[model samples]
Target: MPKDKPLNAAARFQKTLDFSAADYYDQCRNRTYACCFSVENSPYIWENYANGSEKGKACIVFEFGKLRAMLNSALNPEGAILFYNGNSCRQIFEVNYGLVHYVPWGSHRTNEKHLSNPILYTYLKSDRFCEEHELRISLSAIGIGHFALKDGSLIEFPPTLQLGFDFRNAIASAAIREILLAPGADSSFLKTELSKLRIEPAPTSEKK
Candidate 1:
């Protein structure tokens, strides 16, 4: 779809539904900005992606937008603080945006945390909800990958299907109050880790 077409399609979608004016507005917004929501005091849930162990109690949620903006203003940062599982075989993740971007450092999962690692990066094959979905991070060990549902519903993929990254940056793009980071992650660490990544803006040709 073209850049201008989404809004027009969204408008048409709204009119076809039997929703009232107010309800129609809400539905259109939901469709236009899928996976977006407020999380002022919303409870966060965390678990071992490889195992179902309860690790939610150890995580600390921060507004990603505020943190991102604040860190950009700083200079000579150290490294972002990230939660560690202390176990090599287990992977821990917050269930909100399906984060798979692991902080690289002295950790057991050394191979999984690198920003440029091919196993961690993924091309978005398809999405059932978000329109602005594309290349995502896939944490295969936990059965989660890119373009996965944001409603926190887990599904098993076929053994032959290789998964990609699952982190949700779009839904958390503006004033990301709902995105969850590891419990101990800090600005300095995030700066150091992010600086090492070969990230770039997606090309216009890739946007669906």
Candidate 2:
């Protein structure tokens, strides 16, 4: 038997960024798509995630197609597009891209069985390679894993696009929230990008 260790943020971050393309895809071979879940209340999700608690909140089941669509859409300043009940959701997060791949499903060991369901992982840190580019962009990659719940439930996510050209880095939640709360600002570029991706807020839900 193996001992389960507590989740450490620093350690988790380190493990995720140390993978090559071959290493990532080899683990993802012949895996089936599982279910997707939504964290409607992000604070709760973050709190639980921060404490290393597997299941601290309830997640509403979401659509797999919608998740794929949003993730495949053009990168936005708001970060990755998350769908809540099939509508475009801005509250979505990039989930520490590297952590997405390295997380062990049932046990702490890294293996193919544990790599079944992978999602698009976004590297949020800003990089300014050229002074000509105005905005800093994060690199997007693919990963697989899920958040294990205490009650034997798992919240799954879909794979994000790994386009080398897409530079939309994950934006901070505070900034996203501000944009949602205050509708007016200089977001012409953002609006144009969202339109290109066919992303819109769910009719029933308020912009968050």
Candidate 3:
């Protein structure tokens, strides 16, 4: 696919879908921004090729778009927050289960919606998600306090999956929210943790 083809294809896809317009729109949103729904985690083992300085440890690479999706899903906002990288953000901590560390990865989409679709490949292959990152995107679908589904279903949040979507996003999501919003939360925690690894932008850097 080329830079100027996704919207046309997606728009065509939107018109041809069998689901409701809302579902159709969300699908388009996720597809156009795969990173918004997926993550690539790896052990911080100083694998410079993968984690240049982020080594001898463990961490989750929150896909930029995926992080947005997670937060949007949690916050239950209208559409994309339009959150771009380079814009300084505060770190939230003080929750339980440690989801507090899951912050947005600092990489922005250089091109427009028509340009090379954005992706988070470097972290995808960072050797974390493949091995231990059982990030179950399904958990993100419902039960999150921030997200009010189209069907009006607000159930209990699931336990946070160690790396991905293994247990419950509801519980994990709440914890994450607490951490980020907690009074004690600070930037040092995130900066120190983020600096531990060498994150790379998606090589393909495009969505399907």
Candidate 4:
């Protein structure tokens, strides 16, 4: 999950849109899952994400195009199928990817145009985090199984769901470029673990 500053998606729309619109946006957002990455492998990222941990910290460098292709192929092959009222329906399962746009707080104002596609708000962020240089991959399945119907009754599913992908296939596809261990990470432990999996760890680089 990606955390944002206070003035995020919902806050940006609260003042401009009506209550219903805002509520709908929140519902849609709840069904969305996002993964964030940074273009730069920086000390700031290690300080915040690694938390000075001495173990279990590593930054994976991925070939973005191959990664995207692998995700699309593994997770949403032939689109996603849904059951509504006992009838099967097909919905395109799309993964949206783009750079995060940072702007001053309160600069984003919702308008009539946004009503048709409010999920665009997810990619916006407060300028305070500009140093992150974030690239985000998000999947929004607003109608997954939330409103499944069976024999004239609503079949409820969990509000949140987990999605998985083929990790071994991703690695085999040459999606991973390198795996950089964080400063002070437990190199011996990590190397041994990776070795057991037959993975060769990249050489440790001098800390910045």
Q: What lDDT does each candidate get?
A: 0.31, 0.33, 0.31, 0.65
Best-performing candidate as measured by lDDT? 4
| RMSD, one per candidate, in order | 21.9, 18.5, 17.7, 7.0
Compare candidates 2 and 4 on TM-score and give the better one. 4
Cα lDDT of candidate 1 equals: 0.31
lDDT of 3 by residue, 1-208 (tens): 2232344344433444644423433433332221222233333222332232332233343434444445445433342222213332222111111111132234332234433312222122222233333332321231112333335553222333222322134324332221121223454655565445532222455412
Question: Residue 74's C-alpha lDDT in candidate 2?
Answer: 45
Candidate 4: tens digits of C-alpha lDDT, residues 96-138:
8989888775555545233446456778888889889899998
Candidate 3 lDDT (Cα, 0 to 1): 0.31
TM-score of each: 0.18, 0.18, 0.21, 0.70
For 97-140, candidate 1 gives per-residue lDDT tens digits of 32233332232232222212222222212233223322232222
Whole-structure CA lDDT of model 4: 0.65
Clashes of each: 16, 4, 29, 0
Worst 10 residues of 1 by lDDT: 87-96
Give the alpha carbon lDDT tens digit for every residue of 151-197 in model 2: 55544444542233222222211212222211233356555655676
Please, what's the RMSD in Å of model 3?
17.7
Which ranges in model 1 have alpha carbons more than 4 Å from their true place?
Answer: 1-51, 54-59, 75-125, 128-208
